[model samples]
Target: MDPVVHFELPCNDRERIARFFEQAFGWEVQMLGPEMGNYVVVTTAEPSAPPPAPPHAVPGCINGGFFTKTPDMPAQFPGIVIAVQDIRASMKKVTAAGGQVLGEPMMIPTVGDYVAFLDTEGNRSSMLQPLMPQQ
Candidate 1:
């Protein structure tokens, strides 16, 4: 089964939200520029220093981000991102399983291909096919 690798939510004031999370939970926040859609990345826990993690992040730890909410997007509620090996196949699988793929997958520079979708229950979620490891 594909694992849930990330979480996401909507934010209004990026700076205000960043301060709240940093002070409250001690989470590190990275506010992206407008070129990156002004996304706010929240890193709850960094990768462990003692043990090696390879390409994976801190074991059992998932990082998430915040997106600017827009009225056109339905169910702007919190969502999770599932890691997949093949997004096109996964999209087809989601359709076969009664989920609706929202739009075409967009690549996040140095990140991966991402797309949102609606589950069978109409809940918003996302899928990510992380970039292939470079040699």
Candidate 2:
């Protein structure tokens, strides 16, 4: 089974967007790596879910983050990526389900492997599988 682990944000001015997020939601922005063009990752320091407590404890919390991309990248590849166990199998299912592959699957360097495709509704989305080997 697969799940959505991260989401990318397509922005024209990364700094401006980062500032807006910081000021608007108190989201901590940590600029990762060198600014290679306008592509960057905007991360919220907050945890995805509140620290798990006993079953009787209070409810958990959730947060979000960003990954900047060249304006064109988003058009070519939407900012959303869903997790998958088998990329090839998923692609096949996507096609069988009336979807289409936008482009070939590509490795995302240190991040992971991803492929872009259109859902049955013709909306752009991606599927990703982590590069790390399971223990």
Writing each residue's lDDT as its tens digit, candidate 1 over 90-113 gives 999999999999999999987799
Report the lDDT tens digits of candidate 2 across residue range 1-135: 565565566665668878898899776665655543435454444443345321112223322345455445534434466778888889999999998877778786665678878887667777887675434
Off by over 4 Å in 2: 30-37, 45-79, 133-135
| Cα RMSD (angstroms) for every candidate in the order listed | 2.2, 5.6
Error of 2 at 77 (Å): 8.2
- Estimated TM-score per prediction? 0.91, 0.68
TM-score of 1: 0.91
Q: Which stretches of candidate 1 lie over 4 Å from their true place?
A: 49-56
Ten consecutive residues with minimal summed lDDT in candidate 1? 47-56
In candidate 1, position 118 carries an lDDT of 98
lDDT, candidate 2, at 11: 61
